[model samples]
Target: MTYDLVVIGAGPAGMSAAIKAAKAGAHVAIIDENPVSGGKLLGQLYHEPDSGWWVGRNIAREMIAKASSLGVAIFRKMEIWGIFPKWNIMLNNGERLTTEHVLIATGAAEKAIPVEGWTKPGVMAIGAAQTLTNFHRVKPGKKVVIIGVDPLSLSVAQELKMAGVEVAGIYPPPATEVSSDKSNPKQIIQGLSAMAHLAPNALLKAAGKAANHPTIKNIAAKCYPSFGVKVWGIPLHLRKTITAIEGEKQVEQVRITAIDGNGNQKNGRTKTMGVDCVCISGGLYPLSELAEAAGCDFVYIEELGGHVPLHSPELETTKDGIYVAGNITGIEGAKVAMAQGELAGTAISSRLGLLQKGSDAISEAQVKVQDARANAVITFQQHIESGREKLAQCWHTNVQTSSGKG
Candidate 1:
């Protein structure tokens, strides 16, 4: 089939982009591997201080409704195997899609910490727990031990607790070759120190801010409360590690121990807590394989969640007629992904010569992207602002080099 624009994800970003382009008179079609369009939005349930409860599935339904009403084609349960030159997307079902423009909003994948006994049935990635509890309304287990302490794990832990699941504790991951820096106690403090603004009280807030200093980070790691500090009545064990998950067929218990500033287990007092489930969070990274196969330039920016496609502020990838948005561009929340989708839609419409006020519309959309960033709920990386600036610089340099060659 042929379309003016084909979007490769049905998440918030892809659906919103389709709505934008379709409204601007561009024929659009969107595809996804899931039976529904919500993507990870289906698993998101959180209560912000100001925003109240954010039920992401509800928001996703609204977007899907708007896009379907706008005549944008929706292809559900479809997977794209690859992208070819001059805009051809090959679906895994043996169908080929030809398009004038392509947008890769494939979103992100959860990184996992492979601890001992992780292959057990009850052990899963933090995302799987979120999906089972929030999306499917199925309890993962009676008692759960979560490994890793970041925004996603923390938010999901809160949700699991609200769902009546016994949250044993939220502990840091084991320091392995894959992610030693993140697993280290001091490194985690340096990263989380940037989130001090989200601290509830003056005391914890001050502690978070103070942990930013190298000397203070070491002190904080060593002096962390043995029982852990309660945030929302859930124990966040910042200086502890889950060494092994033990079970015959499913997760039964976790071997946990206290760690010093280096994350090495302290001598004595290795306790085993019974937990029917274990959720491991190794953070997230951009899913950019589609972009790479499509011949776009890439750069690794840790702040942006690993390697991402080199794109402009307007979401244009280096490859002509190819665009990217949402987490595929960089890791942010659903709100920012939706804003970037809107921006991408506007940019694609303008390039197609369908928008009469294209420049003005693009400029307006850029402000929305910035505003979305300011109000983002879960900030995975502390230095997102710097990551974006670096991305923009890379884009401009590539553009100049191409122009020179021509």
Candidate 2:
């Protein structure tokens, strides 16, 4: 069947895009591989720290309800294998779909961090642990140790703790460095500077102003790289690295080596921690295979979760009639994805004269999207705007290249 807009991936982005387009009178449909919607949002459960309450669960429910109310058709458990220009989508179930405009909101997957015995039975990605505990109500393990120091890892560790799982502690992953990898003390200071926002408003303001300064930046981060041990009740060990997961059947214990401030392992410094589960999380990257297959141009922006499709402020890809949103565009969380999805849907609907009332729909939607982005706390792409701009310029200069070519 042909649709005016066919959105792939039914996550926060896809659902929001379909709802917007359908509200604008376009025949919209959303397809996803999962039997349910919400994507990573379903697995997510945490206090926003800023908001001071646990969210994600009710938000996903509300979004699904709104999409259904808008007459947006949802097709679940349909895995899309290929996407062709003119919006021809082939599915693994031998079903085919056609659309005038396609929005690839396939989102992202967890980045794996391989270590010794990572393939053990109880070892899994932090995302998998989240899915089990939050979605299925199945505790991943009685006790666990999380590997990685990123915000996502920290947040998920908190969730696991709330789920009655004993979280031993959090440690840094093995850094991937080369001879050419220059150590930038400023990077560490910048991260610390950012973390200062978690402090009181007076400190946050001071840190923001001092972040660009060299010496003051270090002073700002003096108390940072520190977790709320009292709140989560989990130790934060930034100086340790997991060397191996030792077990014959399942995860029995993890071996860790002490590291210097430079992230190099200190000679003969090691310890073992017993745990039934080891949740490894390096980070996240966009799942842009469908976008690449559809011939959309991608720019390698590591901050945005590797190669994301090159798009404008309105979320339209370089290719005509194709758009991308959510983590597929970058690894920003659900709020940004929903806003971007709304923008894409509004843009396409306006171009096709699908607006219910008049041209006002487009303008109104644009304003809302802008507000959503401006107010978001987890705006990943904007957080590294300079890096994004540099990557975009680099991609533009080398237009002949395609992602996955290497």
Candidate 3:
């Protein structure tokens, strides 16, 4: 069927854009590969610490409902394997639906870490762990050790804790040496104070309130490390390397060694940590392949987690009738993705002459979307910068090791 707009993926971006375009009197059609339309939002757990803003599924549901109200056509389980420069899309399910405008919202794929024994049954990526627990309702293991210390990994830890699994301490990769001369006393104090205010509430309510009780206060004071010059008031553990994982069919123990400044494992110094499963959280890479295929210009921005297409404030790509939104542009949260979706929809609507572009009608919608984008940029910058060095190190090591194996 010919349409005014054809949205691919049916995730937060595609669904939102479709609904907006349909409401504006455009004949919109959305195609999704999955049986459902909600995308990753449906598979994410509620209790993950940083996953508080997962409105994508809710937005998708609402968008679908609105689109149905507007008589937009939705094709579920339809996979588009190819896109032409003329905006003609090839679907695997033997259907050819052409549109005047196309919006690609196919999101990113998870990258796997290249380590020995990583292909074993018990080793999984953090996203896979989340999907297993949240969607499949299957616990990978009762005891789990998470590698990497970031909001995403921490969220997994919180989920596992709520699932009644024992979470071993998070292990960050070795940090570069801090220069003694450049250390600021005021900055250090501020950091410590922030951690002190934040740490107590990290625990369950009963555990947090028990610290005030006379008996538990003494125990908490003794067990918890003092807030000091450490990183986040928690000591940064330096390690040489994770040597090997040992078990028959499932993981049982992890081998680690202390490393020097150069990352060399100290000889004859090894330690073992017992855990049933290992989860690795490296970082996210932007999925911009489809945007690139649509003739959009891309710039390599390390802070945005790899190559991102150049898009206007209105979320329009270089292509005249094409738009992009959500994590496909950059690795931001679901809230920002939803807002970007709305922005793209409005811009597309204005471009098609279906909605008035500058009649003071779309100004409020534009402002809200721009504000969300600005805030997302600020919050993601810190994470993107801090994560770069570690991710680079891992990437180089993985490439070298994988090449040798090949």
**Candidate No. with top TM-score:** 1
TM-score of each: 0.96, 0.85, 0.73
In angstroms, give how far residue 50 of model 2 lies from its true place: 6.7
Pairs with steric clashes in candidate 3:
240-258, 240-259
Error of 1 at 272 (Å): 0.8
- Clashes (N, CA, C under 3 Å) per candidate: 0, 0, 2
Best by lDDT: 1
Model 1 spans with C-alpha error above 4 angstroms? 200-204
- Cα shift from native, residue 216, model 1 (Å): 3.3
Residue-level lDDT of model 3, residues 297-406, one tens digit each, is 66666666677666655666657677777777777666566676777777777777888653353566667655765444113333343443444444456457757999
Using TM-score as the yardstick, the better of models 1 and 3 is: 1
Which scores higher on lDDT, 1 or 2?
A: 1
Please give the RMSD of candidate 1 to the true structure.
1.5
Tens-digit lDDT track of model 1 for 190-308? 76655565664453565667666767767877787778877778787867888899988888899988877787778885889988999989888899898999889899888898999
Whole-model lDDT values for every prediction: 0.87, 0.74, 0.61
